[model samples]
Target: MTANDRTKSTGSTDRTGSTSSAGTPGRPLTGRRPLAIVAAAAALAATALTATPAQARPAHASPPTALYTPPANPDAGRQILDLVRHRKLADAAGVLAMTATPQAVWYGGGTPDEVRASVRQTVVDAARHHALPVLALYDIPGRDCSQYSAGGAADTPQYEAWIDAVRAGIGSLPATVVLEPDSLALLPSDCGQDDARGSRTAERYTEIHYAVDALEPLAGTKVYLDAGHSGWHSVNDIVPRLLAGGVGDATGFFLNVSNYRSDSELAWYGKLISSCLSYVSAGGAAADCPNQWWAVNDAQAWLDAHVHAAPSAMKHFVTDTSRNGQGPWTPPSGVYSDPQDWCNPPGRGTGARPTLDTGDPLADAELWVKIPGESDGQCTRGTPGPNDPERGYQDPPAGKWFPQQALELVHNADPRLVP
Candidate 1:
């Protein structure tokens, strides 16, 4: 059944004033606090101003040569501009930092306040340099489908407040906010089996709608709701969820935020949903939406014929390029032993440099939604220490690198790393 049908049939209440608590389930170190504290401490240290003679500089020091310039393509440039304007300087920095070797920095770990401040400052700095900023919002409750990185605001209310702080931080700035990754499609509403399903469903809608309501209206900000990879949810299944979660308010929906689905696959999936959305908005039954089953040989051609350069009403989408160059890894046998592939699958390498150009009119921008180099989470593979093979622990999941894995990719890409 369509998500809308499911919602209506379930008789879920309207999520008007529902709110979540600040506390999240799981370990204390799991959420954004540790990172926030670290950032706060760093800010404090930077402010002390008791620098060594060499570190001190004149207030009038010339701004560093505009470190980043938006790419020539409008879509790509717009993504860059959004990042710069919104104060995502470090993210902006990643566009260049990974030029030599593919890498990116994920920035949501810090405290809500500190992260908000850092993003604000980053935008201010980027504006000074005539650049744009791109921001990624990944803290959806039950994030990562409630896996290792699975902590979020205790409930929806707290999440709304946290989102408000983030929105306030971007006050009056031009930015692109890639809303909660995998929050829409990868939700656990269905995972709870018999008893827990009801509450999980309510929580999912509450959080999604709250986020859209809070972020979509921010001036100069474009919020793209996350749609899972092409392989996951069908168009019929995802579109209604988008609607319930306020897709109408969002700029558009984002696809393949952190997964390895190919551009061709993502484009197809995106267009399919976009069409379904058009039908739904027109008062058509989502279940009867035949567009969902349409076949196509070329995603670009399909998009070319049907998709708009930008949606008539909503904002638009932005995708990630953090680690999809080679697509998904298929294990010869049991890879994760339990569906751990979502964490940090083996043999995967970095993808294209994060850019905004999707080469399709309907696609708003392409970005590095996944911050490369950050740990996805600990896994069972190689040694525990920095890619040490003797320990046989693997790299942390997702953006992290197992030194050995990194070396393999580097050597494969350019024989230099193999000495």
Candidate 2:
């Protein structure tokens, strides 16, 4: 997901902000609201005994399967604890609830042993809290295509080994794995990816297919391959990539992973993708399926006319709502050579909190795949310099938490943070 960067496209979404139904009735975006610290610990213990994952798990991890639970000691959790120790009410800060839940633990740019250790440490940590972990696998052969977050396995063999290590670390525990973002969307055939005869792109598919084979069979792990987001590709265009990269055996494909499209838009996009896939599976033409660019009424009516799959038969999906509170940024006219709006966008806030009850059956959950505080690399917006003039400061390197940006997100959160 390259730190959840939105594609470089202008659309109706650019004018209107995100429309989230996180706190709406029947949504129940989180397990519970703020409770006393002692009460929360008791609740956690009670949850472990009774909670069950949305899906069953295999014979691995102690007690086998448990529902996704929040670690009581996530960094943000600890930060809130420290605040409370000083008579502050950071616990009252809704960000605490968001931080307490399961989030994707990204593994990239590390040696096999290092990756194993990191993955093991993360899963073990989450297990202590009875929470399932969402692991993002991004160390593919040509990750990020030499862009801001560029770095991946040197070759396919190394990539396969990396996946093996991740699986070993998982060790029969439940996991939601987001495999390789942008690999399918921005293939070698597109843009700067210039592998001759498209061999690199072919290898990319091979690597992803190999990843699917290696990880999909693990006990209760739900593997969601990437389909970018609604703003990036038409459902028909990405459907081929998902199939080529092996989505049939996967739990489903994720949309807007680490990207900031609206929750409502993502829900619609995901439903359309699932319908189109079902349509194609039923011997229908991919060209006939309407995509995100299609008018809403026309697309829904078309699906009604042709799509025969029930909601249960359709593949499920998850959306990244980490920082889409205000949706995409629209820069001033001619502000720079390129207004890299997604890069460290000035005022984006955190979206819905992580939860299982997303109110939509097809949506297994609305996850926070992109960590809120992390910077999206040094965004020059087309000007070449270490400092991004757009923000008037040198942004942190990609994957590093930006305190200033973190504070911004906390302040601008959709539900609004109290502390």
Candidate 3:
């Protein structure tokens, strides 16, 4: 969910309150964490089955499913609208709706009652407008590994309580939940997380399974598990993570949530992963699946030959086209030890506008999961100083808007945002 990821500053008023945290930095890694919890995974399933939501769905409720709809005017959309109104950014005015397209309502951090009140109000407002509510269920324990986006629920029980509040908040209404963006992508073990016998990662999967089982069963909710992105994980690599994290129980999984990767690549990568999943489900070894490192043509050819399941049997997926139109940034070669290419790469532009009308049969939608103009973090890129080498000034702490980047995204929009 990051372009890459760190440090210093009283971060967002949300959780950790720190903008930077220790990390491997630069390109993402699968880390040295062993997924040796096969036995524990089965046990996690048992726990999930017995688990209950923070707020239980009413036993009797036949509410109609909710569909996504954009408000004619968005409450948070004013951030960008104000930019246009005051700055006379006439050329980029039409792009206001892109910002207003109702990305997600982050549960950031709060007590259960407070969370319930806020979430209930968000859903109520969206329902009033017939718009689908996109809730980011963030606040899980060990969130962000104490990194820039740090701060989730303190522990499993606390998380469950918060989740219960979330469920209670939604009540009988329909919603789309971007369940914990990096939960699966960056597991505790990856960040040297310590627990008993691969227990931390196991708990994460358990927590995810719990949420999926709870949310997916609701009458009007779709839960999309995290798949990181095409650039991050191989099809074979991620399929296991997905399966382990309960993708079957989800409406589908999400890709490139807050990173930059071309739609063509993301779509192709998604198809391969989905196909590989079907292959494995039918008893093929995960190792037999084609991966991102394979040549594009060969990958497609592999899927054509091996995946036997009909399209409907395979899981569906969504892509975050938030800021990938220009793809990722490339630094001049031999510049530094690490080039965190994903974090706030300069010159990136907005990709396709958010829409549910993706023509691909398996793609459920293309969404703006990452709020456009938001900073990935203070992208030092290993130069070791306040200012980003890519951009002269030190960028703001993560999640805050980067006005120059935002303007660049609007100006260089691929199809060009026209209202």
Q: Which portions of model 3 miss their true places by more than 4 Å?
A: 1-87, 91-95
RMSD of 2: 7.5
Q: What is the Cα-based lDDT of residue 97 in candidate 2?
A: 49
Choose the strongest candidate by lDDT.
Answer: 2
Judged by lDDT against the true structure, how good is candidate 1? 0.50
Error of 3 at 132 (Å): 1.7
Which residue ranges in model 1 land beyond 4 Å of their true spot? Answer: 1-112, 193-197, 290-294, 297-315, 333-339, 380-391, 397-402, 408-419
Candidate 3 lDDT for residue 11: 18
TM-score of candidate 1 to 2 decimals: 0.66
Q: Is candidate 1 or candidate 3 better by TM-score?
A: 3
Model 3: per-residue Cα lDDT over 1-419, one tens digit each = 23222111111111111111121112111333213222222233233234322342333244333434333223224334344334333332433534545465666689999998988877766666566767767776777777767777888888888888888888777788888877777777767785769898998998888888877887678889887777676777778888999998898888776677789988888888888888888889988888888988887788878887887889889887877887866667998555666667667677887777789988987887677766677767678768877777787677775666666676667877742
Worst 10 residues of 2 by lDDT: 11-20
**lDDT per residue, candidate 2, 277-395, as tens digits?**
88888888778889998999999899999998888888888887878887767778887877666677777778887776788978987877777666677666678876777666677
Per-candidate RMSD, Å: 13.3, 7.5, 13.6
CA-RMSD of model 3: 13.6
Best first by lDDT, ranked:
2, 3, 1
What would the C-alpha RMSD of candidate 1 be, to one decimal place? 13.3
